[model samples]
Structure formats: C-alpha cells, structure tokens
Target: MSRQLLQEPVQDLLDALTKSEGPDILSTFTTSPKPLAHEHGLPQLAPFLGRSFHGQEGISAYFDLLSTYLQIENMKFEPEETWVIDESCMAIALRGTATFTWKETQHSWEETFAYRIKVAEDVSDDSEKNGSLKVCEYQIWADTGAAYLASLGNLDDMPE
Candidate 1:
C-alpha cells in the first residue's frame, strides 16, 4: 500500500495508546471481543504477578501483563518519541516514560513508560485497497492477542 493510506490509522492508534484508552484502542485492532478475564481478574491479582511467566506468551500478552503492572505501580505515559511508518506494513514506534503515583505496594516502580507497537489494516484478497496498498498480516497478530492471550492456558486456546 502507499505509505499515505496508512497514515491516518497509524496516527489514530498511537493516539489511543498514548492516552491509555483501552477498549477504544483494542477495538480498532481486533475482531474478537476483549476477554473478560483481564478486566475482572487483573486488579485482584496485581500484587502477586511479578513471578508470573510473562515471556511465555506473545507480545500482546506481554502488554496485558505490562498494563496490569503499570496500574499496580501507578505509572502513566509521558511519551518521548512517536514515529509512524508504512514499510511492508503500517507501524508506529513509540517511546515514553511513565509517571507513577506511588501506592503502598511493595513493588519498586519507575516513573516512566516506553513502548513500540505496529498497527496495520487487514487486506484480504477481496479487499478494496489490495492493489493500491500493501497487504498487512494484521489478522495473524490480532487472532493471537484477541483469542490466545485471553485464554492464558491451553484449555482456552483457539484451535488453528
């Protein structure tokens, strides 16, 4: 796709992340519903997750865990660098420091946040812009985050 076509979507997604607008940002990126587990179960387990297996999952899971951790640590985003691009896919790389409101929690917290995410639009064989814009592998990434991370264990993992 021409780099110009991706500009708006990339900017909008980055703005959503910078503002920490949860469902708003997620909806643009996924087809499946946001799983209820992270919403209902996170706050209760916030203080206990440091030893949790983070890297075992993909980047979205990492972000979920990271988001939960930020809430626990009371960190807020203070974006440093924000760049938008359209290479093989539309992407945005953002870096920022999080400012924390210290709570009584024992976890040592930093007053900064840094993140880099790439958001791309799905282009199917029947998509309107298929010939004008680069097709993106967005569905592959979305399927994993929307379906896989919410499950946490194999019992809930979506079958290929």
Candidate 2:
C-alpha cells in the first residue's frame, strides 16, 4: 500500500536536516516572494534562542551558529504522535536523538530531543500538496540545560 500523507515528506525533511550543511535544511522550508517571510520563527533554547532569527537569512545564520558551535551525529526520528492542524494539514511531535558536541570545548553528549512541527500554509513554488512537506514553524525542545552548560565548557562537570 502507498505511504501516508505525512510519513514520507516528514521523513524527507528529517533526512535533509541531517545533512552536513544548512542549505538542505533551508530547502525544506516554504518559499516566499519577499524577505522576512518568516517574520517570527522557531527555536526556544539557549544558543539558538530568542527572536533574532526571523527570516531566511536569520534561519540560515541559525544553522551557521549550530555548525560553528555544535555537532550533531546519528540524527534520526522516533515518531511519538501526529495530529491534524486543519484539513489537508497536520503536525507531529517526535523524539530525535543525536550525539551533540560543543565544538568549543570538545564536549559531547547523547541528546534526546523533540520538535513541534507546523506545516507551512502557502508555498506556491514548493507546495506540500505535491507530497513534500513545507515547514512554516517548528519549536525545538532540546536539552537546553546541557547546551547551556556545554556553552560554558562544563556540561559534564555540572552538578546532577
């Protein structure tokens, strides 16, 4: 039987995110005519936290920061739940794991995280109806405490 509407595209997006560069991550987002298409966007954690990363450039920069400071390995998804947002649309909360490192301190940890992925509403050039999921917004629920301590160069050394 054919795959479900979300399974295939979401999987593709997750795979794209695992690439060694940010363009692949950018490619998964919805298209826009003007700049700042994403006026308000994701990630509510230290390092990538705050509202500074608003548009495509900001999003790209976010990835740049990640590349500069953090390392992700063996990225994979463990589906937890999927729910509808509206007709012909849905969102997912899934568990993800990766070996994350703070490149500055050469500190690494096995992290289990999550994402609240919201499907992009309108991306004329790259429509999700064509079977590719376009992301509008996603909130990352990662190990911020570890990342915070990692940024300080003592993640493992911190008290339990």
Candidate 3:
C-alpha cells in the first residue's frame, strides 16, 4: 500500500480521539481476539500512571484510566518520520501536542510517540478477517515531571 493509504487509519484514530469520540476511536482496532500492547512511559508521578496494557480489555482499562485525569479538547499528531517495514507493517514516529483539562485544570502537553501498526488481510470470513490496519503497539515518551505536577493541579511547580 502507498504511504498515504497506510496513514489514513492512523489519522482517523487520532482525529477520533481529538474529538473525544470514544466509539469512533475504538473502531480502528481489529477484533481478532489477539493481544495488543500499549505502553505509557511515565511512571514516577502516579502509581497507576505509565502502565502497560494488553488485549482489548486492557485497552479499555487504559482508556478508562486516562479519562479520569485527562479531559482532552484537542490532540494533534504530526508524523515526523515513517518507515515501511514490509508490505504488512509500518512504523511512524509522531510528535503530538494536546490541550486538555487535567485534574480540573487546563493544560497542554507535547510528546514524542511511536506506533507500530499492522495491516490486516482481507479474508472472506468475518471471523478470519482481522479488520483494518490496527495499531499493534504504541509507545509514548513525554515530560513526566510536568505532567505529574499538572495532574496534581500544581502549575507553579512545573518547569519553565
């Protein structure tokens, strides 16, 4: 597939999340009963923060955890680099910025993200088809200290 075609699903997912459309966000995944891994790379701030999730259930749990602290108004993802690993796989390096209400205080954050996505084959059987291109792995690296302080509504402690 072309790069533009490969990027469409990812862009769709980002758009849905930016709009806070939960159902649309969830539809970008495959329902193959396989495990999907998502890792958040901030741990020192909150105990429940920066956890790794697996499978659809784990994905739902991760979203639930995020909803408690983050009321995101907008999330914009810009692909800084992209590499096609093969016909069925691709990796995208993204720089993302978001404006959100965290812990009742509005804040904005910028992060570097990486996504490894796999394009599912079009099989005849519904059960056999894995659906569309789905994000198999997502990793985020951000300023943990700032995000931590924001989560506590302590803007004064945040670095300049």
Candidate 4:
C-alpha cells in the first residue's frame, strides 16, 4: 500500500493512543469479535505488564493496570519515520521525548522507545473509518531498564 493509503489509519491509531482510554482505542484495533492482542505476560518485568490481553475485557484489564501504575505524558511517534513493510506490517520506532511515570512511586523520566504495529483492512462499520485499516498488532519496545527502575522508585537516582 502507498504511504498515503495508511496515513489516515496510522494517525487514527495514534490519536486513540493519545486519548489513552481503553474504549477509545479498542475500536482502532479491530472490529472483529475475537481477541486481537497477543502479549507475553511479563509480570516479573513490570507490575502493569499483563501476560496477554485477549478480547475486549482483557484489553480493559491491561489498560487499567497501566493507568493505575503508570503515566505516559507527551508520548510521541515519528510518523515520517514509519516503515511500512507490505500491506500488513509496519515498523515504527518512537523517536520523541515523553515523560513516563510510575504512579505508585511518583517516579517520572523521559525516555525513547519503539514499537511495531500491524494494520489491515476492516470491512466492518463505516464508523470504523469507512472500511479503512485497523490495527492488528502493536508491540512495544520500551526502555525496560527505565521502567523497572521507575517501578522501584529508583529511576531518578540512576545515573545517565
């Protein structure tokens, strides 16, 4: 697909993320009734990290944990840098500054991260962007070190 064909879907997904509410973003993911997210539940790595968020209910739980424990402020993605690999896959690295806070510890710091996303056409309701693209998978490559330190309330103390 041409980059132009994906601009709307990508922008819509990003907007949903910025909104950061579970319901607001779920539609951006898909219109199918089946579970869409597949994640490796990494509880040992972070408290908010769920093993896998399956369906809508699971998605809600996943976001709840995140909202309860972390605050992502000013998170930005470089659209110009998004690498579209065929029509079903894309790799886009986060190249902007964002303050990530572990809410329980009140630890906040800026970090750069990356994520890979997959988008596909959804022929569901026109309400979902008139059969435009929908996100199939979203994989985050966050700064685990920073996340861990922040979770322990020690990120700020770590030296650059």
Best by TM-score: 4
* Per-residue accuracy of model 4 over 11-128 as CA lDDT, tens digit each: 6777777765523776666554333454344568786453666655766676787788788899777755445445445433334457888888898888776655666676555564
TM-score of each: 0.39, 0.72, 0.71, 0.77
Off by over 4 Å in 3: 20-23, 33-37, 79-88, 104-131
Error of 3 at 2 (Å): 3.2
Where is the poorest 10-residue window by lDDT in model 4? 87-96
Candidate 3 pairs with clashing backbones? none
Residue-wise lDDT of candidate 3 within 1-160, one digit each (tens)?
Answer: 6766667666665666776554464555555544354545556775445777665677667677778776655566664254434444555555666655566666555544444555343332465444456555555565566667777778665567
- Give the per-residue lDDT digits (tens) of candidate 1, residues 49-153: 323221113325645654653443333333323344545745544334443321233223233333333434444344453333221212111122321233333
Candidate 2, 80-110: lDDT as tens digits = 2443233244665567889999888888888
Rank ordering of all candidates by lDDT, starting from the highest: 4, 2, 3, 1
Cα displacement (Å) at residue 36, model 2: 9.9
What clash pairs does model 1 have?
Answer: 1-133, 1-134, 96-113, 97-112, 97-113, 98-111, 98-112, 98-113
The TM-score of predicted model 3 comes to: 0.71
For model 3, the run of ten residues with the poorest summed lDDT? 116-125
Off by over 4 Å in 1: 2-4, 20-23, 32-67, 72-86, 101-114, 123-160
Per-prediction backbone clash count: 8, 0, 0, 1
lDDT score for residue 153 of model 3: 72
